[model samples]
Target: MRRGGRERSMGFFEHLDEMRGTLIKSAIVFAIFAALIGYFMKEFNEVLLWPLHYVQAEKPTLVLELGTTTVMEGFNVVIQMCFLGGFILAAPFILFFVGQFVAPALTDHELRMVLPLVFMAGLLFLIGASFSFFLLVPSTIRVSIEINELLGYTLRWTPGSYYSLLTWLVLGVGAAFEFPLLIVLLVYMGVITTAFLRKYRRHAIVVIFIIAAVVTPTPDPVTQTLFAAPLYILFELAVFAGARVEKKRNERLRAP
Candidate 1:
């Protein structure tokens, strides 16, 4: 069998071979990125510690220090930092390879739709990660410092714990920014419609606030609002885009 004269049907082993090749390429890309990050570990360390610096700049009186409690903690943090940085840097290449492997199965129309969504997903993730790094993380640290001061305790954090918090918050918010893509996919699949989204707009707002509160490290309403506001905008945009997609789908179905 053939698909649009672009892809030929493959046997079990052939599919496995293609998959293996894709994985191999992705691994190579990841490894190269990891090595590069490891080589520049000092710069990467500064980037990771930016939130701490940001907090310090805001409040000169606050004293915060990051230390390693265990003998291997620094080494472990370095390894974690390298891998995480490497994966982030290599993600686009890996996605491209995966797309290439799967493209044979998609027709031109599907490819067009999928490629744009993939690009948008990457863009949204970057935006979300930047927001967390530049704003949310610093605010969280400041809040934590204030709370500790209130309790008459000095602020000190382990490198492992700090990196864990940084990675978790950044990656989690980045992933959460893919929410609109999921919404669009559901709309395309006929699982939901623009009307449905609009009807549940109020409910969605409540859920969005809930997610923001949960995702944010502090109980500060400002931080939660900062997180939720963009999500709400994206939700609205999704509803609009879904309406357009729904219209196009209906027109296509009605054609000839």
Candidate 2:
């Protein structure tokens, strides 16, 4: 019993040590990417400003001139963008280190399942972010300008504020795309099955629309629809996928 307690304590401390090492490695990789991205400020700036260009191309009437509100806001934007760029560039390594720390405790089947799910989640997030960057942001910008114009207000945007909005829009939309994965995971874990999803589908969609309304940076119908539509579609897909997984799980259970 004493030996067992000592072994358990050692295992706990070992895991903590592993997590610490993984974090240190991730930090190192992130720092390297931060330096590289910071050095390429011009390119990064161009990419960051593409949504503005996208809006301008479609709307000649919109007025947009981003300014700094503070003495150091310019540098602050630079640092923030650089840090974001670094995280984006180093995402794979970061995921890897995180996975390494978690993988040891998982069973072989769970290990196999986790990696592909992680990859899919990451891929879906990037797709959602790109969708926001290229389409949603421009539409939001255009709609916001139109609404402000209707209210008799002139457009004056600060660089810091604009960039912050851009970041949130991308991240929020990216996160919005991740909900279906959660449903699928829950199905796999047998917490709830496809029937539950189907039964509550209407309520789920209403909640999704509410979430979309809240999450969309601009409260335009178009953006909200864009957010809600895919979410509903993904929920449908999740239902089908969940049904299939449930069938297989039952089959395996009955086989033995």
Candidate 3:
């Protein structure tokens, strides 16, 4: 159905059609960005591979001479990195399409929150990816290498594997960092109250620790804490954001 079909709700086929249209538009936008970014794959590869290079040069921990076991591995890594770069760069527009799809169903308060959230969402993703690249991924790799050494196995890691791991870790952390927006959205929609967040603060902290452990890939407490710290802070920020919006919503409700 169309955006404002109130009298007659959307049938299944109509919903499917709208979803298909949204997917097509999203794909077109992604393709354009991917093609442009793919042209600059070299620069993108350097950035993505920084953690590996840094660990190798600085620590001299392991002879992680990144190799290509397959004839096409080099070309494949370039393609993969290009698409990953394109996705990271194109995230904002992708979010815009998402916003467009959801805007019609939003209340005034939610509509107002959308722009800031969109911007924040992108910024948060970058921060998260940076965190993973600069610290978490490197530390995890170092620890893994140490373990392999202890087990008396030499690591002949391939380029494809390295970039694959990097892409997933960076993107995973980035996507995980969007949790505050979820919290704020819930508040804007009156789904949950500030009191609930406050009441479950301890439980939230425990869950955050678990998430940190899962995301960091390193077993050490320090590395886990590094991941957990920002997450806890983000959760607190979510609480404050939600509270502030809920207060505004309450004030507007009492307005003349």
Candidate 4:
């Protein structure tokens, strides 16, 4: 029995080593994907610009300005877009790789909970990203254009700056959308209870607004409200989900 216990302990270390190998493999895959994205930057840049282009329905051409100071600066913009595109494109695979790696350490019940949560997180993130791209970006753009026109300034945006801002906003929203998933996972792990979440609802509202303030690039309160409101709603949803999960767990325990 002592020998068996020692072997089990060694197996635990072996599992850790396997997890390390999985992470290393995932990193290598990401590097290769990044390289491929770098090679096809123009195509990716065009795709990224589509949201902006579609929004400017009246304008035949959207002009972006850059300093003629150095030709290399232009190439740098492409590289930036490539990296952004690569990360977005590789997100699903990255999640899958991470899931597969950690899944071995989780119990079957935990695995069932985690897999669904992972997929839901991915979906929610994409929805938030699309919302930012389709709604928030265009609104911000129109506001900027109107403000610039009033100031007698031409809308001379740099491609590098433009893509950077757009990508940042989209990714930020996407990451923010995972708030519910995180909360639910915490509840599942018993790190937090549904009652605790409910009790903190008021504080959460204030925190959500603060988060929104930090997230929004536009200084407008409207944009901040838009982001914050949805996040708060998601928080409520998470609380309800946790309550259900907790109730189900209690019922199982009480059963024969």
TM-scores for every predicted model: 0.96, 0.90, 0.80, 0.81
What stretches of model 4 exceed 4 Å from their correct place? 1-21, 58-71, 252-256
Local distance difference test, each candidate: 0.90, 0.84, 0.81, 0.78
Candidate no. 3 TM-score? 0.80
Best by TM-score: 1
Which should have the higher lDDT, number 1 or number 3? 1
Candidate rank order under lDDT: 1, 2, 3, 4
Backbone clashes in candidate 2 total 0
Q: In model 1, which runs have C-alpha deviations exceeding 4 angstroms? A: none
Q: Is candidate 1 or candidate 4 better by lDDT?
A: 1
Residue-level lDDT of model 3, residues 40-148, one tens digit each, is 6677667777887877787654566788888999988877766777677767777887777677666675566777877898899999999988988888787777788
Residue 128, candidate 1: alpha-carbon lDDT: 92
Clash statistics: count for each candidate: 0, 0, 0, 0
Query: Against the true structure, candidate 2 has what lDDT?
Result: 0.84
Across 1-256, the per-residue lDDT of candidate 2 in tens digits comes to 2131322334667778888999899999999999987898889888889988887877787677888878999999999887887888788899989997776566677777899899989988998889888878887887888898899998888889888888888888888888878988898889998998889989998999998898887767888998788888888988998898889888877896
* lDDT (C-alpha) at residue 116 in model 3: 85
> Candidate 3 vs candidate 4: which has greater lDDT?
3
